[model samples]
Target: MSEAGVSLEMSKGSAPLTPVLSANWGDPRAWKLVNYERRGGYQGLRTALAMSPDEVISLVKDAGLRGRGGAGFPAGLKWSFIPKDNPNPTYLVVNCDESEPGTCKDMPLLMASPHTLVEGAIIASYAVHAKMAFLYVRGEVLHIIRRLQQAVAEAYAAGYLGTDILGSGYDLDIMVHAGAGAYICGEETALLDSLEGRRGQPRLRPPFPAVAGLYASPTVVNNAETISSVPAIVAHGKDWFQAMGTEKSAGFTLYSLSGHVARPGQYEAPLGITLHQLLDISGGMRAGHRLKFFTPGGSSTPMFSAAEIDVPLDYESVAGAGSIPGHQGPAVLRRDHLGGAHRDPLDRVLQARVLRQVHPLPGGHLVAGPDAAQDRGRRGGARRRRQDARRQRPDRRQILLHPGRRRRRMHPRRGEELPGRVRGRLPRRPGMAAAALRAQHGLRPRGLPRRGRGLLR
Candidate 1:
């Protein structure tokens, strides 16, 4: 994180470390509406009903809330963009199509606390004068969709979604719709298209989704996390919500942490938290390992090394770190898999994408070394065939026999350690197992030459 974005904020304010969105996620009955109501769930809707629509939007703005979906647009500010005078019906679309790889917060959230999202959708629709709202979930997670559907039904049964909710004279309805499982539909215009029973494709902007969306009407499309954040901001005052994070990026957010961490689960924390802090509490890396390089936000963001772990994870700080604040949370890669990460066909392909800055290739772009990049399983098959026949392809057999060589061939970027006397250690914290051998065997020069700006690949 840049000094400008977080240093002052850290030194100035006191914040809570407890998880907010995920607090009830561990409860067995969290998915039930009765249990949710018991935990003070529809209160935000009641509070919004008591106040005016404009007041709800204002509260969100004061909370300093931003979108959790790849784009970090402020939720309240985006809500305010809806024109009040339009004759067409205003709509609120809760975009649950979280198709970005490694972005898994919303699905688990719905499975655990589906009512949170349903209530949030209602409050957001009321704020924007949207009588009709839709929870556009991705088609792949059918179970999540079913949970959300049951929650919506519960809301109606409890007088939260149907006519004259809570006797507030504000009638609203929420529908749970599923998309055809296309990642591109996560885009607002494309989502609108898919929601309207059309082909999912990005629409050129001039009339953004706020002005025109589902069924060619005025609409507000927000991320599941972004809309789910609304209920909390409404239930608690803006000041209470603002008390947690940095001045510009306030409140707690659900962070999905996976890959080589002691505790790999959802962590809700104040924005601008450093990975070092997360690692400290997470038991650092799985014993005998430490973070080497990790994608700050999925594969699209820049890969950060151990030296940059102190960078704060807020929007401004991450932007300052020369990477966009990705919607998906961090995917920590440990030094234990250095050479292993590289040889793994998938890891190498993703690394190639991260390594190329200009004219980035599309999702299916191929990397170099076509022959060497042949699937490791295929090479193993060739080795087996060779053993049965003339017993040739000794190099292939060596790779199959040696775990390090096999990992280097399969998972190259994560290719780090292999079992040796020292458990395949290198000179440094995240040193290369192969490099350690080259150095130990005296193959390296007195001063190892720097190559490709410190890139092992």
Candidate 2:
């Protein structure tokens, strides 16, 4: 598991955690400029402002920084793709619309430390020679939006944003846009469409975002985490950033560990770290439970069995294992989570519907009020009289008792055919309906109460 560039020997027993973006997450009020500046924040932007844009791009390219946005495209190469001879203005768009299930690292990062993103955006824009930048965030996360807005406002006030930033004579402005909660907007072209006041949809490639994007000009759309890592690369040398991860995949990244684990949250580690190491760092799965399967990235990505738990979770390794490292968040599902030894929650919810159709409540009453119950009883008594009269008739008893000839009625609420007929071979007594249901479905009272009082009696 130990690669050439990765440093796994630093830890005594467990894997080493290199928290670059998540370094100040534990600090109190780390989102504010005061706290962030205390921890050497904006130093990267200051360093970036001193160097030429081409040099900055070369530095990132040399660092081997790949886009954290699923595709793992080279970030510096993407920046270098902008047509310098084009007459139109260049723009940078940060993709923060993390609507994918389990890809929750961006929201928390924005909530905890918005300035890191702000500084990174400034450096990224400067490197790409983009005068205007947009930080496109998920509209559903209003709190994160407000936090990011405040952080950007602080940056502008501190002379890190606007014209002549830190006396470098570089002009750049960042706008925080709130998207209307569309998952498709996570795509770069769809995001560009939404930013332009139209319905979010993907555009045809050919003239991509780098060539003609964001108002028909050259644009660079990078993931939130991808742009956030730029400040660190600029602050620290390329060699320092390259030393953490593998030869191809360099730098530390946020790995969101969720579900069935004892410690479920973002664990910022270097690339090429395996799930076994992550599990050891996170305190493993829940007590008395074992891992069954886990998604390598988000829910859309293919799931990996427990046998592949030790596969290195880098871009190449995860892809080689037949799954994308989408958002780098692994949702761990335990054996018990599959509802094998346990009653599925959906069944428990529908059990009441089964009871409503099969058995009336105590005292021959429906779930309705006493008045409705009395009315139902009157109607039921009339039906019972008719049924008894029919039972006395010759052919009725023979046909009702005949297993093959018994008629089945479809449930009114649920369009499924009930087992036999509700009035026929099925139970009529209260609480017996549950037993009959269990018998018909071959379902056990896995989640039943201690006294055998539950969804399935």
Candidate 3:
């Protein structure tokens, strides 16, 4: 009736919650460096410079700042994980890939206050004893990328990002790398692989990025929101940070609102803020519409019914309600669309745009007929030849021996390995199947060749 029900605990809190990082989101030119400087944006970098790197790490640890990324790992704890004696250069990678559906906070944050992120990067790099930092952004957001590049240039121009910042002898260089968009890359290991110029895919973790990451060096990979929150934690002491939010989940976060809500935007509040409180700030569901199920954090997080609205939006509490906060926020739906009866207007428009670009194939699969397959093969073969020719340059003889030896080794295994290798190499080729390769190798269909029996010895 009254937007939604506010939690009794939130209503009972006597102290006012402070929203530091997101305090200026509503202001015009909120993203500009001039506006940010006027509001004491880079002040944290100044404070961070004066303190010892260990001291900065201690303050963050004392602040109880957990990761704003999906994992919620302690930010300070993550920094401390890097070995102090290690000679390898430590790195701080800010994950700016806001590809998670309904997660729009980082992009707007960058578009508005790229310096805040840059300043935060400088501070974070200092805390982790990193001399170099990289902000890996989503590739498709070219405008934001340009804005960030400009912001980095400004920081370098001001001597805030380069050597001996504020005469503290702490040097940091920031690089903005645009990712070829992939959802899996948001995962820390996958993000590292993408940063390394490879196709984005999740890597097994154990030797998590804290130990071996980014050129096989100790690295700290944090979400954009997580690193952006560092400046505020440094400016305001750790206790000031710990004072807000719950015990395990300390500090404020930006909650993005979209879909059927009367108002849709970012709301900066403490971690435990409930959906009801958010709805109150966002102007509730659209007019006469009622609440249906909602995703707690984008499509990856599990959905919650209207009855679970009071669950606190912290990592622990929301997880207790059968969802994780992650980087995204809840998508409120007015009715169930399980039967494909309805779709979001944005989704429909996107679908139409995609459909316009490519002809729909039977059963929604892209079809490649003989002609198309032949064209693809020719193009692929031509590209391979060009690459091989480049590698065959006379001046490149130093690396040629390595390639030759690899080819020779692989060739020796071709008889017994041809089936497996052919299947792996030409998985999509129509006529050049693994069975054909096996037959060409003179190997039996299900057993080894007569000569292979003696070779096995």
Candidate 4:
């Protein structure tokens, strides 16, 4: 191979911190192409390049890698749905518009090891016979978009992308798109609408993206984490990926844990990992507080209690426990004593990862919690005026805060952020947990189109 073909200098990367998805996160040069190649990165794409697309798809199906996105569908099965005989060109659209309340994995993956995603995208596009792939990122995350763009440039420069890649006679191009800051766009159909420069909204289904998507052509849409896993699966072979996790849900995955814990961060382990194991490994509840309520995925997922701590965190187990393992992460909160936590000014603590507004009648059985909207008439006119003034901004911090026992030991102080921090939660090494304020959606299939006609991918 010519020196200009690929530049893998003497750069080195650290072994993953006992993490499957984040093995190269700690490496200072992990974002660079040379560093990526040094750690056996793009080799997956090369491996895929050697196999027929069908074989590649079968390998993933055999590995049993479920989607990291909330829906938990089989990744390979989703890919296999794209029609090979279609007359129009097929496309690969990556859902990177990560705006979930308690989720934060893809952004950090892009930041720490962007080339992993770029290589994975190339391989996925090739497997589906797609000549083009598009990554849809949220407009607010400009830095993440830049990082990914740089990775694509590096891949093209290394001859790992574009026409005649690595003398394999394959061609592919990747485009990075930024969407307007809308949480709803995290939905696949809305994301597709936004991608087409139309208003972002959900579409009907039946003709899912795999059949008729983006530009009315067959498309395969997957989130960043799902596609990022493809490289490892393609490189390591089916058994290597399946060796760790259970039979139904094979391979290691990214899990984000937050709230009042001794340590809270991203934990990448096999599918059936239990929260008891996570809490035991980390320092357990913050300041040694006992667990109270926790959301296994996000607010959208039903919350579980302390009694179910030992439940294995897999699709099957979580479902049996009355909650969907929509995503494998959990946001844990400790019981709070309302009186002391908030003083005269009404100090509040946000214990859960995502706290959506819930209003209750004056004396109803399901009254809102401390973090919920409080009684406005409690204070005199002046105090109410001050409260109204503060409410003007009503930023996330103010809204997230809830009256609780005077501060215990919270990792991230209230009002310290604008909702983001999965990177903080990622344990670069084993036996560590990260406390983070916020982090990080789901994709839907087309059963029918609603707004105009069909659903988005």
Candidate 5:
């Protein structure tokens, strides 16, 4: 095993913080190729170059490395999906378009150590037999783009890239592409379309990227952190990588901590670490404030309240806790941050955007039931009777605002119980919930081509 040059910090029996991708971030001039190589950087690529591509793919497969991107798909399995018999050239595309709100990990990683991704892309491309790879970054991030370009240039100069890399017969070329700052290109298929100079919108699936991708050839698209993780896995071996995270979601990853916290930045740790633990280690919330709500992944993931601080920040655990673990990291918001009278107008706008981006509503099961309509009518009738009784008493009741009380109400005609956090937050009218259900069921048809035949060219 090669030296990792990373140090793990632990406090007695508390949760430990393991830094791999971010290990050298604090080092002086860490982005330079010379500085990166001095710290056991491209040793993974060296080790990978010695093995057959299949063996390399199998190594990563056994390591249990999941994608750091929002979906958390298995990384090695994605690589193996490329068809061996296909005559078309294979390609590897790294998604550096960190356009999602609160997704801060990739841009910082590129700025701090662009070579990590460069080396990883080369290794991944080799594994999938891709001769070309593209780093599609958001065009608005000019500094990140320049840094990646410099890193690619340095890799070529050092013979870690280009033809006949490091005395091995394998050859690869990495191109840094700057996308026109479209948020939708963060989606893999849409990113591919944008890479080909088309409108950035999601392409239909089934013939997924592995089957038909960039230029209609086979491609393996991975997030920046997902690809950057490859180098350490190659150098350190499967067992070493698997030893850090849980059995299913193995390996260390960078978590971007921001919003209403004392220390907000990137904290690399094993999967399954809790938000409570993260907040504790990061100096907790801002002074005199308490955690109100947070997005476990980003605004794209469902909101988890302060009650869910202990939820494990892993793929399965976070999903189990009603949120998604992703590279967007946890954006913590305290009570005062949202409820203060002096809150900035920009903050209000951001809150609205966050609400809009949260993962789509829970399925129709929340409102659909055999006797749902009947049960809702009965409840509404009982409430009306009680109101009539109160009105006849001639007693005036003082209405007081209770912050702890449920502020919103559900539709009167719906009976099924919703999740605790979502219980009374919907509209109280009779048909709103049903309308939402209709909209949910209509989503599929909306996504289908309007021609009513098949996918349009």
Candidate 6:
């Protein structure tokens, strides 16, 4: 039997079919709900809904499905992580934040088959006992957001979502949330924090969200592709799912070929497929551009040179190649003649601020304190009294006042001159010339020359 539910029917001399996920991507309306339903979509949900949640989990576990979100943890094991006795609501969060520099599969999948995702969401939620699900998509993709919203509406209308889904007594609500476009937010905990209307930054993971997540409830977070793969597992039996790929890694995965590739797009094949095989199917590298380097997953994953292209796309095999297969795709980077590279100036200033924060003050305090505030005020008053006496002191300009504290070497543009503070030789800007000066010294202006002819004079 073929891996994907359908059997491989090859023509006289043609290669076997590449399977359904990617086979019809080129179709104009490939993303339309009608086209997907016609192609045997939602069959998995119907099969999944009929089975008990434990049975569904067992099927996926036996199928050998692993997390497709870089970590490659067993999907079944992840679902099992949710506490059975938790009284709080359980959640299924779809990590659609495809912001990994080279990872593009989630966005395309959402663009093409929004319902496939909705269906998977329902099935996954059912298996994990989640009453609600959240699709955390990257904010940059407005088009995808609009498409998904419409898809959710369609699913609700069709009784695939909301209460009493297909008379199975399972109720699910899916909310498509657009993130504020932060890369760190893709980290599961950070994604939750951002979802809760806080800054997107990684939180210490020990609670791991499986125990305390999203509003402090048990949450099962899986990548979009991982969840999307559920429908097939549900429709097809576990043995059928296990028929494809290697022992550790089973099922078909979508590989996104981008950058220098001739036909760059999603390629659906069993997990262990090699990069060479993908290149062959996608029509290989562009005309004359040779692959100099490539990222196995995205920028976050260590970069891999062309020497490792033959590595299997599976997590184990790719890990052996000294790079994590965060996503099974080749972000080919070819040599090109471009303008000079310039670093962001704000980065330097931020670095300096961080360094200063880490350094110990004169009194051995790692941070400035109230004493520093009094000292700053006293120094300011003394400086004003001795204005003519300290004309030659260039260091007099370096005082900064923050909330409840003050420090020397203030940021050059922080506009920190207190009411009694004496003026210094630093070029003044409105509000905070000292902070601006510090930023300028840190090359915070991206090497651009500051305005005004006074410096030239």
List, residue by residue over 376-408, the lDDT tens digit for candidate 2.
Answer: 453578774465344432112110011111112
Per-residue lDDT tens digits for candidate 1, residues 17-136, read 556778788787899998898889999988999999999989898888998886688899999999888898999998899865556788888889999999899999999999999999
Candidate topping TM-score: 5
Off by over 4 Å in 6: 1-17, 23-28, 335-457
lDDT of 5 by residue, 1-457 (tens): 0122222333222246889998999999899999999999899998999999998999989998889888899999999999999999999999998865566999889999999999999999999999999999989999999999999999999999899999998889999999986666787877888898776645545568998898889999999999999999989988888778776778788878888888899988888777777777777777777788777886545567788877778898887865567664888887655332312221222231221111112221121111223334534787744654454211111110111111122222246543333335665433335335434444221221222222555
Question: What lDDT does the true structure give each of the candidates?
Answer: 0.69, 0.73, 0.70, 0.68, 0.72, 0.68
Candidates in order, TM-scores: namely 0.73, 0.72, 0.74, 0.72, 0.74, 0.70
On lDDT, the stronger of 5 and 6 is 5
Q: What's the number of clashes in each of the models?
A: 26, 0, 1, 25, 0, 14
Ranking by lDDT: 2, 5, 3, 1, 4, 6
Per-residue C-alpha lDDT of model 4 across residues 251-301, encoded as one tens digit per residue: 777888887887778888777777776676665778757777676875445
Error (Å) of candidate 1 at residue 162 is 1.2
Candidate 3 clashes: the total is: 1
lDDT of 5: 0.72
TM-score of candidate 4 versus the correct structure, residues matched by position? 0.72
Taking all chains together, the TM-score of candidate 3 against the true structure is: 0.74
Can you rank all candidates by TM-score, best first?
5, 3, 1, 4, 2, 6
User: Residue 28 of model 6: what lDDT?
Assistant: 77
Off by over 4 Å in 3: 1-18, 339-457
Q: Which stretches of candidate 4 lie over 4 Å from their true place?
A: 1-18, 337-457
What is the overall TM-score of model 1 with all chains considered together?
0.73
lDDT minimum window of 10 residues, candidate 3: 397-406
Worst 10 residues of 1 by lDDT: 394-403
What residue pairs clash in candidate 2, if any at all? Answer: none
